[model samples]
Target chain A: MKAKAFAARLALALVAAGNAASVACAADFDWKKFQGKTVTFLANNNPVAQALLAHKADFEKLTGITLKVDGYQEQQMRQRLVTVMNARSDEVDVFMSLPSREGPQFAAAGWYADLTPMTKGAVAGDYDYAGLSQALLKAGTFDGKLTSMPMNIEGPILYYRTDILKKCGVEPPATIKDIEPAAKKLKACDANITPFVSRGLKPAIAYTFSNMLHNIGGNYIANGKSNLCSAKGKEALATYSGLLRDYGPPGVVNYSFQQISALYRSGRAAMSFESSNELRTVMDGGERLKDTALVPFPAGDAGQVPTAIGWGMAVSAHSKQPEAAWYFVQWATSPEIQKRMALQGIAPPRSAVANDPAYRKWIEEEPVRKQWQAALDVLAAKGSSEVGYPIVANPESREFIGQAVQDLILKQKTVDQACADADKGLDALIAQK
Target chain B: MSEAAATFTEDRQRLELAALSAPAVIFTVAMIAFPVVYTVWLGLHSFSSTGKQSFVGLANYSRLLADTEFWHGLWVTIALYVLSLVLQLVFGVWLALVLFHAKRLPGIVRSLFISPFMMPPVVAGMMWLVILDPSLGAANYILQSLGLPPSEWLASPVWVIPTVALIDTWQWTPYVALIVLGGLQSLPPSVYEAAQIDGASAFKTFQRITLPLLLPTIVTATILRSVDLLRFFDIIYITTQGGPGNASNTLNIYGFRVGFEFFNIGYASALMLTLTAIVFGAVLAFNRLRGAVAW
Candidate 1:
C-alpha cells in the first residue's frame, strides 16, 4: 500500500513539471502574423534545397506566405548573388551560403541582414532557439550580429568496402599511418582495383587536404604570415600527395567529387575519402549498400580534428521584406523541417532533431546509415571550421593550397619547392588584406 | 536642275543617311567602346568590396608586370593558340581538297561532317571530358586494342596543351574546311584547264598555281580564328580548369578566376586590359599580312 502511494505521487510530479515547461513557451504567438506576404529565395539547387522545396506546399499552407525560388548551380548561384548584392538590389530576399568559405567576405561587404534581433521577437511559440548547435551559430555570427542559420552539417569521411578489406586480410584504419599499409595490402591482393581515391583537382584539393593538414597539426598562417613551409605542413603535403601518387587511380590529378564518387560506387576503389554528403549518391545503385561502411577519417597527431562546414540560409541586407524573409529562414531551419530533411541524407544542425525518435528509427533501418550518423556525430562534436586561412581572402587561399598539392601529385616539384612557392604566393594575398 | 534645288536634295540625302546609320553607331559604341573604356578606368583604380574606390594609378599595372604567373599564362595562351591554329588550317585545307575531288558526297554525309562545330562549345567540352577519361574512357581502350601505349590525355601536364589543341581542332576543322571549300569553288577553272593543256602534273599545279591563290582565303580564316583561339576558355575550363600545377593556365582563365572568384577587381581589370591589347595587336598584324597576300 505504501509503494503504490509513492508511484502515484511520482506521476503527479512529472505532470507538474510538464506544466511549468509549457508556461515558459509563449502560447499566444501567431503563425499568420505575416500572412499574404511574399519572399524570394536564391537557392543553390543542392540536396538541402531540393529536400526543403519538396515540401514547399506545406510551408505555404502553414504560414500563408508565398515563396518564390530562384535556383541555380553552386558557382552560378554565387555569381548571381554577387551581381545582386553589389547593386544593392532587393531581388534576392534569402539565399544559401557556406560560412567557412564566405562568412568573413560577405560580412565585410555588408551583404547579410542581422538576424539576432528577429530571433528574439518574431518566432513561433515552440521555436526552441537554444536547441541549435551553438558552434554553428557562433560560426554564423560576425560583429555581434547573427548573419545566417546552419541548414546542414557536412565534412569528409572514409567509406571502405567491408568485403574487400576482409578478403585482403586488412583491418580498418585507426590512424593516418595505418592507411598506407592497408592500401599496400589491398593493392597486392588485387591489381585491377584502385586502392585509394580522393580529390586532386587544383580548385578542389583544398576541401579534402585541409582536413589532413589540421589532423597533422598544421595551420595555414603563423606569426602573421603564410606557414605552408613549416615542418608539419610539408609533412602533411608529402603524405597526402604520396598516397594519391602511389596508390590512387591514374589521372587522380583531375578527379573531384564526381569522379571519386563514381569510382567508389562502381566497385573499383577499395577506399574513398570524400564528402559525407555523397552518402545518397554512393548508395544509389544499392550494390554496395550491404558491404560499405563509413567512418570518420583516421586520427592524426592532433587527433581527429576533421574539417566541418555547413550550408546556411541568410537574408539579404537589401531585402525590402526582411521580416518575411526571416520567416522563410526560420521555417526551413526549424526542427520539424530539419527532421524531414535528415531522412533525405542532409544531416541536421539541430541537436533536438538529431535525437528525435523518428530520425533514430530512420537511421536504424540500414547499418551503413547508422555508421554514417555516428561519424557525423563525431564531426559535429570535434570538427573545426578552418577549411583554409581565416581571412577575407579565404576562397583565394584555397587555390594556393590546391596548387601545392597538385604540384606534388604531378611530380612537377618536390615537397620543399611546392610549399615554398605556395608560401610566397600566399604571403602576397595575406599582405593585400 | 536649279542650284538651290540640288543643294536642298543633297542636304536631305545627308540627313537620311545619318538617321539610317545612327542605330548601328550607337550599338557599336555601347558594345565595344564603353566596355573597353570602363575596363581601362577600372584598371587604374583600386576598388574594395564595401563600395570603397580609390585611385591607385598604375600600381595594379606595376604588380602585373612583376607577376610570374601572368607571364606564364601569356606563354601558355600563345602556345595553345599557335598549335591549334596550325592544326586547324592544315587539316581544314586537306579536307576541303578531298571534298572538292570526290564531288559525289551524299547530303547526309556532308551534313554529318558539319555537325561537330554546330554543337555548343560547352556541350563539346563536356562530351570530350567523358571520352578522354583515363581509365573508363574508350580512348585508352582503343589504344590498348591496337597494341599502343595508353596515354593520360588531359591529366599529364606534359601532354595537356597538345591534347586540348587536338580537341579544338576536332571541333572547328570542318568550319575551316567550309570556308576553304567556298574559296575552292570560286577558283576560275580557266587556270586548271590551261595547266591540263600544258600537261602539267597535278602536284606541280597545286604547288605553283593553286597554293598561291588560296593564301588570301587562308589569311581571312586566320584573322577570324586568332581572335577566338587567344581567348580559348570553354574546353580547357571544362576539362582541366588550369590544373596540374597551372600547366594549362591561360591568360583568359587566370583573369577570369581573379575577377570572378577572387573579386580582385583592380588586378583582374589590369590583366584583362593587357590581354585585350595583345589580341588587338595580333589582329592588326594579321590584317597587314592579309593585305600583303591579297593577289
Candidate 2:
C-alpha cells in the first residue's frame, strides 16, 4: 500500500512538470502581434523543403504569420544568397546554407545576425534547443558568436548490396584492408559489377576527395600554407586515385555524385561512399537497391572517420524584422519541429530528438536506418573539423585542384608534377590576394 | 561670288552624307565603343564581383601574364578553332558538292541536312553528351557489340578537345554546307557546260571553274567560323566544362571562370581585352587574305 501511494505522488509530480513546461513555452511569445507580417524563407530544392511545406500551415496557425518559401538549386541558392547579402538587399529573411563553404564566409563578413542573445535562460531550457548536436552548433558559431541554426544533420556512409555480399559469402568490410579482398571476391562472383565508384571529375569530385583526404589525416593547408605535398596528403591522394583507377567502372573519371549513386542503385556497383541524404532516393525510387545496407565508412589505418556536410539556417543581417526572424528560427529549430522533420528522414541536429523513442522506432522500421545512425555516431565521435585552407575556399582553387587531379588520374602528368604545378598556381593566387 | 556659292554647295553635300551615316555611328558608339572603353578601364583596376573595386594600374595585366592556366586555355581555344574550322570546311564542301548534283528529293534532303543548325548549341551539347556516355550511351554500346574495348571519349584528357570539336562540327557543318550550296547554285551553268564540251572531266571542271569562283564564299565562311570559334564557350561549357583537366577550356570560358567563379573581375577584364585584340588581329589578317583572294 505504501509503494502504491509513492507511485501516485511520482505520477502527479511528472504531470505537474509537463504542464509547467508547456505553460512556459506558451507564455514566451505573442503570436497574434505578428499576424500580418510575412516571413520569407530561402530553401534549397531538396526533401527538407517538402517536409517543411507539410508543416507550413501549422507554423502559420501557431504564429499567425504568413510563411513564404522559395526553393532553388543548391548552387543557385548559394549564388542568390551571396548576391543578396553582398548587396544588403532585403530579399530574404531566413536563408539556408551549408556549413563547409558559405557559412564561414557569411558569418565572418557579419552577414548573419547574432542569435546568442535571443536564446537565453529558462525559455531555452523549456524547448529542447540545448540538445543540438555539438559539431553542428560549433560549425554554426564563429568566434564564440552564434551565427546560424542547423536544419539537419548528415554524414557519409558506405552503401553496399546485401544480396551481393550474401551471394559472395562475405561480410561487409569494416576496415580499409578488408575492402579490396571483399571487392575482389564480389567481382569474382559477378563479372558485370564495379567494386566501387566515386566522383573523379573536378569540382564535383573535390568534396568527396577532401572528405577522404581528411579521413586519412591529411589537410589541404597546414600552418597557413598549402599541404598538398605533405607525405600523408600525397598518400591519401594516391589511395584515392588508385581506388578509382583500379576498381571503378570505365567512365568513372567522368562520374559525379548523381552517377555514382545511380550506379549503386542500378546494381552495377557493389558498394560506394555516399551521403545519408541519398538513402531515400536509392531505396524508395530504386527497386533494385531496396535491400541495400548502410554502414559506416571503412576505417583507415589511422582510424579516421568522415563526416557528412550539414545544412543550417542563418538569419540575414539585413532582415527588417530581426526579432521576428529569431522567433521563427527558434520555433523552426525547436524540438517539436525537428522531430516532425525527422519523420521525413531528415536527421535532426538535436541528439535528444534523434534518440527519442519514436525516432528509434522509425529507424528500426528501415533496413538502412541503423547504418546511418551508426555512421552518425561514428562521425560524431571521430570526425574532426576540416583544416581551414584560406585558398581552398576560393573558386579558382577548385578549378586548379580539379584539373590537377584529373591530369593525375588520366596519367597525363605524374602526381608529383601535378601537385607541384598546382602549388605554383595556388601560390600565385595567394600572392594576388 | 559664283565660286564661293559652289564651295558652299559642296559643304552642304558633305553635311548631307554625314547625316545619312549618323545612326550607324551612334549605334556603334553606344553598343561597341562604350563597352570596349569600359572593359579597358575595368581591366586596369582591381574589381570583384560584389562591386568592390579599386584602381590598380596594370596589376591585372601583370597577373594575367603570370597565369599559366590562361595560357593553357588559349592553346585549347586555338586548337579547337583550327580543328573545327578545317573539319567544317572539308565536310561542308563535300556535302555541298554532293547536294549540287542531287536530282531527286533535294528539298527533303536539304531539310534533313540543315536540321542540326536549328537546334540550340546547349541542347545539341546535351544530346551529344547522352550519345557519348561511356556506359549507357549508344556509341559505346555499338562499339562494344562490335567486339571493341570501350573508350572514355569525354573523360580522357587527350580525347576531350577532339570530342568537343566533333560535337561542334556535328551542329555547324550543315550550316556551312548550306552556305556553300547557296554559293554553288548561283554559279552560272555555262561555265561548267563549256568545260564539259571541251572534254574537261567533272573533277577538272570543279578544280578549275568551281574552285576559282568559290574562293570568296570560302573566305567569307572562314572569317565567320574563325570569329565564332574564337569565343567558343557554350558547347564546351555544357559538354565537359573545360575538362577533363582543362583540355577543352577556351579563352571565353577562362575569362568567365576568372571573373565570376574567382570573383576577380579586373583580371578577367584584362584577359578579355587581350582576347579582343587577338580576335581583331585575326580579322585583319583574314581581311588581308580576302583582299589577296579578290585580286
Second chain alone, TM-score for each candidate: 0.94, 0.90
Residue-level error in angstroms, candidate 1, position A291: 1.7
lDDT of 2: 0.76
Worst 10 residues of 1 chain A by lDDT: A19-28
* Residue B177 Cα positional deviation in candidate 1, in Å, after optimal superposition: 1.2
TM-score of chain B as predicted in candidate 1: 0.94
* Per-model C-alpha RMSD: 5.2, 6.7
Ten consecutive residues with minimal summed lDDT in candidate 2 chain B?
B44-53
TM-score of 1: 0.93
lDDT of each residue in A309-381, candidate 2, tens digit only: 5677778889998767776777788898889899888878777888889999998886578777777777666
TM-score of the A chain in candidate 1: the value is: 0.93
Residues A249-362 of candidate 1: C-alpha lDDT, one tens digit per residue: 888999999889888998999999999999999999898899999999899999999878899999999999998898899899988999999989899988789889999999
Question: What value of lDDT does candidate 1 attain over all alpha carbons?
Answer: 0.89
